[model samples]
Target: MTINLTMALVLAVLYAVGFYLLMQRSLMRILLGIVILGHGSNLLLQTAGGPPARAPMLTSARPEEMADPLPQAMALTAIVITFALTTFLLALAYRSWTLLGHDEVRDDVEDRRIQRLERRLAESEEDAAEELEKEATQ
Candidate 1:
């Protein structure tokens, strides 16, 4: 199966940027990231289908000559799902903005508590490691 180099590169870029944006605290960037990720997925689905050919329609073209319809259908489904997800995310963002004046994601108290616990655990482990090193040196 011949791979489309252009589509592959685009997919790679989309996935990279999408993930980077997804990691940000801004809701807008996160939404953009999801959309970009969706585009990457669609491109990947296309690449999974073999070489380019005619559309799989009721034409005079032979079955072998016609392009596989499955990939197209899958891509369409992905598009619809992505659209719905984007709309939902947008609505949430808008509501947050309207109520809070900004769409910044704030961590809850539990997150802070978990971070403190992790920090203490790390410190304890570090002290134990140092003690072990000192005993070995002696």
Candidate 2:
């Protein structure tokens, strides 16, 4: 895999900023973060395939010198997928703004309730495990 220092640095920055934005509460910022993260991953996939070269046509170049097309194809697919996701996010943001007059996402009550239940379940499991261990020892 050929990795240019500049490209790697750029990718790193993109990922860092993307994650930072993703952690924020704003819908538009989250969408931007997802797009940035997608772009960074796409760059990573492209860089993993090594330096660019002529197309992998048999007659046009030697077998050893031909560039692999797999990475580019993968990057293209990711691009399309990311573009679709971005569009979806955009639509969601627009709809949310129209309905609520703002696009900030508040915590879901059901999500919090589920989290509380999960916490209790985990605690009960731990207690049960402890009881089983104590029984085995006694």
Candidate 3:
């Protein structure tokens, strides 16, 4: 198999692992999964463009021996974007942990239940306010 194809297969495996980790409730695992997915995407992009022969600089080189320069450029862009996103995710995770006193995300079922209860409470409060308004009007 070609180098690009091998790299693509590896990237796919990495993405699967990342997806699995992301499904976990732990904030750290989620962050790590995101980073892994980012790296996998970057690798896929690089592999798609094929391997680079030499730098894109204007140097005295044979035309036939040179590889595609686009992949290198794409890799650089992906690296920068990945770095920024990773940093932002880490910061957000840290802030969430500090504020919530726990890194693990609450279970989806529990969260939905709490949300429903909160909505009911809010509706009751609103009804009471409306009744008070009506009494005042009367």
Index of the highest-lDDT prediction: 2
Candidate 2: tens digits of C-alpha lDDT, residues 1-138: 557899989999999999999999889999999999999989898888788788899999998899889889999999999999999999999999999999999999999999999999999999999999999999
> What tens digits encode model 1's per-residue C-alpha lDDT throughout 30-81?
9999999999988888888777898777776888899887888899999999
Clashing pairs in 3: none
Pairs clashing within candidate 2? none
lDDT score at residue 107, model 2, on the 0-100 scale:
98
Clashes of 2: 0
Q: TM-scores of all models?
A: 0.76, 0.81, 0.64
Where does candidate 1 clash, by residue pair? none
Candidate 1: worst-modelled 10 consecutive residues by lDDT: 54-63
Superior candidate under TM-score, 1 versus 3? 1
Weakest lDDT window of 10 consecutive positions for candidate 2: 1-10
Alpha carbon lDDT of residue 21, candidate 3?
A: 92
Write one digit per residue (lDDT tens) for candidate 3, span 1-138. Answer: 166566767987999999999899888898888889888877877777665565544575676557677766787888888788789878878988899987877768988999999999999999999999999999
The per-model lDDT (C-alpha) reads 0.91, 0.93, 0.81
Error of 1 at 22 (Å): 0.8
